[model samples]
Target: MSQAVTLWIPGLLDALRVKEAQASLKDLKLPALQTLLAKADKFAVKPQSFYEQASFLFHQPGCLPIAVTKASAELDEFNPNHFWLSVDPVQMIPDRDTLVLVPGKALQITEQESKALLQKFNAHFAEDKVELIWASSQHWYLSIVQPVDIQTTDIEKLAYQSVNAFYPKGNAAQYWRQLLNETQMLFYTHPVNEARREQGWPEINSVWVWGEGKIEADKLLIRTDASIHSNHAYLQGMANLTQSHYCAEPESYQAWLNQIAGFSDPGNGEIDKHFICLDSVADKLDNLQLDEWLTLLQQLEENWFAPLLQALKRDEIDSLLLDLGQEYRAHLKPSHLNRFWRFKKPLNSL
Candidate 1:
């Protein structure tokens, strides 16, 4: 039986901004990745958020049902009937004429802090028939009895960028914008922010509202046979929706191989398809930490790209699909590996 693997690597193609680091890339030996890119068939795709890309893979495209899908996975008793929106905590840095949105990952918000913050938010807006639900320290949800008509920008796109241009837009835009301002003011004086300030941590001063939608049973297009390996809540939720084999991502390619080797068959044929997301470089790329990004790339070269290339060569995997997020994808087979004449190119060239 032939097996195939698809890798979703978000920051794989981002350019290194630091001039000093450009030289370091030359020193980094990623021969396996270089060869795969050099010989594989490549194509362009419309730039999209990581959530959108994952949704596309699960056949739930267009304005992804991100909130409900993720809520279903996080919430103990998820009510698919209610409309959901991801009202995740964030910090807005005021810069001259704009506010730079810092995502929650940098905040390192504790569970106690999240619960305290949400308690205040939920009480303040309780009369509005909307409640803030704490899914995790980093993940929060807004449950609404009646869904509103507004489009939201995914927090990922707004991270480290000015929020002036990306504020929620649609017929109900003004309402959501007002709500955002109110929430910011509500959190401004909260003990959580006060404690965070004293600790030299970024304040969870506001919430970024996005991924507003309800999950419909008919909309769930599931492919149960394929295995999904990711640490992302949204993808894991999709796996649950599909009732597919889902597992947290392994530390490395070898670790993943070891995990699947122990799987027992339940009268079904061996699962030949796998989807893996390796997104560790995304935060480094977003924060412009060039050295860290290069280090991670080198690590991936050693742990994932190198092993995957060898797997393809040995026919352990018949084909490999590399989704190098935003615009570039590479498809490779064993024969492609034999294309030694296709000279390897520099990492940045892709």
Candidate 2:
């Protein structure tokens, strides 16, 4: 119970830039966040994407490896004891200049289509002891008899980007690359793609395998008193392993408040810590949805920032922590709110 609340908001700078462009900061009602920012201590850290930042919170390099396939397996109700890797179905669009791979999340992929595709993968790779499991149309898992040492990039990270640059890296990079290339060719003329084409659906041309690792016993070593709440599978897995309370994502800030309104005070006399993940902006950015991203920022100002600011003023929370991904985090205590003389700058100023 070292913290009263930790507000996890990704793409703060991008949101800020959009907000500032659409309207002036003074026009927005975010006094709590603004005041805290004006007075809170700030530091620079390494730049990382939302997934990278989230991954580091629970798993230390080597201590708590990110068994993404296993975590995703739990979501799919698939067995987690086997060695696995994430293999997302994607559509590769060839351009006159370059070829881009659009993530499956952006396409309309059905469960039946996924099952058929996975069957094909399993049949083709059966001799190699590699099998593909359809967790969902967007999430697929690859099970192998032996572990793969190659590190691959997240599919979301490569969405709408060139696939040529995403060749696996590490000891077994060549084998993985060859396997992936072969699979793409195998899927190119699959009956599923033909059926999808007839039905006007995007083709499942390739798969991106990444987050390869086994679930380590020490994956939950970073124990914290903070309660975990998120809609993400990985966070839920982390919470389950850490034995912390896990709540589904709230549709509104009011819903979230209702869920944690009665949090019991730790007997150690420390304030209860609440960790929240609000990632709509990041998701929008990945999908190139600028308008939706801007709208979400406006809603955040009205729902989250305004309400949390009022909560702090009422002394319901001891402090606020904003994780803007990477090394950019703001720690704001109630006392900081009183620093009226401190200059309030826009988010991009930092």
Candidate 3:
């Protein structure tokens, strides 16, 4: 049996802005990545955000069950019977006539502040039969006794963009919108925001509600014996639900190989497939921190792409699939690495 690996890297191909950076693309020596792109067979996929791609890969095709999946990972005791939604805090910046959403991750919201904010929110909304639970500074959950019909856009898709077009839409849209407005008003005057204003940090002026759904048993598409490695809460939840082997995101390809080396022999035909999600560039890309993105790209070149190519050459892995976000997939085998005639392209060309 041969082992196969898949790498899901969002924002890998969105290098158009990198071209404008002071750093020359020619100066970035990512021979391994360049070669992989030059030689591999490419396939087009439907464009999707990181969360959507992860959900699709796990076989949940429609609106992502983000709340339930993430709750399973974040909560000490998760109840699948209750419907859940991710009501994460966000900074809504007034950009002229439009309001731009800044994701919670960029707000540097502390656990203390999150607790304080949720304490007030829960009390005010308690009569509505919905309770807010603080899972982390970046993730808060709403537990509802009754299911509501509403469609939401993930915060990842709405980050740094206008919120006008992406507001929740459905039968319960108006209700949610109103609730959001109320929450924003409540947070606007909170001491947390006052302190943040003094410190020059963005205020948590609003909450973004998304990832609403309950968990369905045995719905994951992943093989029971497959291994998953990621730091993402939803991905961890999927792994737990499927009872698949799961580990934290590895620091590098070498680190992953070392960690998995202790597993049952590959010859047993039980653990031939592996999925790894590398999202280091995700936040940087979302925040439009191009300089940091460039630095991380170089680190990826040194830590992952180079070693992965070597692994293919050594037959340590039979094949590799690169999910280079934004509707692109590249498949490569050891044989593909032998395509010396294929010219390597600059990283910016991707």
Candidate 4:
């Protein structure tokens, strides 16, 4: 019989124990909560391999962090609801010992990677057990309990018949990738990394789950791969991008787009369509910050961007626009052609 032996080192165990899983952690508030699950781990296979070597989690109005939860929490003004904060029954982090989390994306890894993944994960994850109930690419939940003593084939059969199966196509896939990358970095250098590695544990290269509060071993729980701990360029960029945003004037652009055709919540089946429409048409206009672009709209009224601005203004969606205009006025300079961008381009290009 192949016996599964897990590594139990001091640094690793202590580090995992010192997590925000306890109820007392809620007192840390939003800023502190943001500090957990960093972007780079020193013990990673590669020195500076913080996963999200790309992208950012900007703090713009629409691009705020979206934390997942079962129900909405009337969080403090500062914390509020963030993109990283998901509030759905599908997402739940258990306060109890054992927990299960269905990732929102597909993660590919090998058997060896699986063991390393568990050790690396167990190191910083202050949990007793994780019955990582996973759904195969075919959308069938495989009842395989990780780090547990139970082996139930019947449960696996039942899961195959009933397990939330929804593919994370576009936006979700991107978010999941970012999350895993950041978590990998955090776990890499986490005190647990060296201890676990010494025990011959591999690394968690990739993985995915259906969603939050996934059932494992007849228990309900939630899990998220938000751990990140790194000072590398990519990690820094992820942090910055998650915090910064290009605020532009002329908010009516959004209202104007809404007033016209092609705007909707599109539901789950057509989420890709929703993002494409919003990103291509509406968000594109809202994200523009060039002073000349706004000027062109205000002056010519016949310029390419003029009609859109006029529509937004006519629809009375001027909150962000007004704010943008006010901020730009506070620090206007002839040299600054665009309030959002500083590129030296042709005036017509504006």
lDDT of 4 by residue, 1-350 (tens): 11111111111112222242333333323221111111111121111111211111111122111111111112222211222212111111233452234332222333444444444544544353322311122121212222212111111122213222332334345554454344556546654445546876533222333222211222211111111122222223223333221121223324323332222234312111000011122223334444432332343223212442332234322211110111010111112222333332221211
Query: Model 4 residue 125 lDDT?
Result: 40
Clashing residue pairs for model 3: none
| lDDT winner between candidates 1 and 2 | 1
Q: Clash totals for all models, in order?
A: 0, 0, 0, 42
Each candidate: what lDDT? 0.81, 0.68, 0.81, 0.25
Looking at model 4, report the run of 10 residues with the lowest lDDT sum.
1-10
- Candidate 2 matches the true fold with a TM-score of 0.82
* Per-residue alpha-carbon lDDT of candidate 2 for residues 1-350, written as tens digits (9 for 90 to 100): 22477777676555445554454443544554566667776756566655566655433343333455236426545444656688878888897766698888778888888888888988998898777766777877766556767787877678888877777899989888888788889998999988878988888988887778766665445445556667777767666655566677665668877776555545523226667886554455545454554466567777787777777777877777777543467777767778778976664444
Question: How far out, in Å, is residue 326 in model 1?
Answer: 7.5
Error (Å) of candidate 3 at residue 165 is 3.1
Please identify which of the two predictions, 3 or 4, would achieve the higher lDDT against the true structure.
Answer: 3
lDDT (tens digit, per residue) of candidate 3 on 1-350:
56789888776655456556536565677888889889999888876666678866655545348898889899997887778899999999999998999999888888899999999998998898678888999899987766889889888789899999888999999999999899889999999999999988889999999988876554545467677888888788878766668888898998988768766765534776788887655545666666666677788889999998898999888989888663468899999988889999866566
Per-model TM-score on C-alpha atoms: 0.85, 0.82, 0.85, 0.21
Give the C-alpha miss distance for residue 292 in model 4, angstroms. Answer: 22
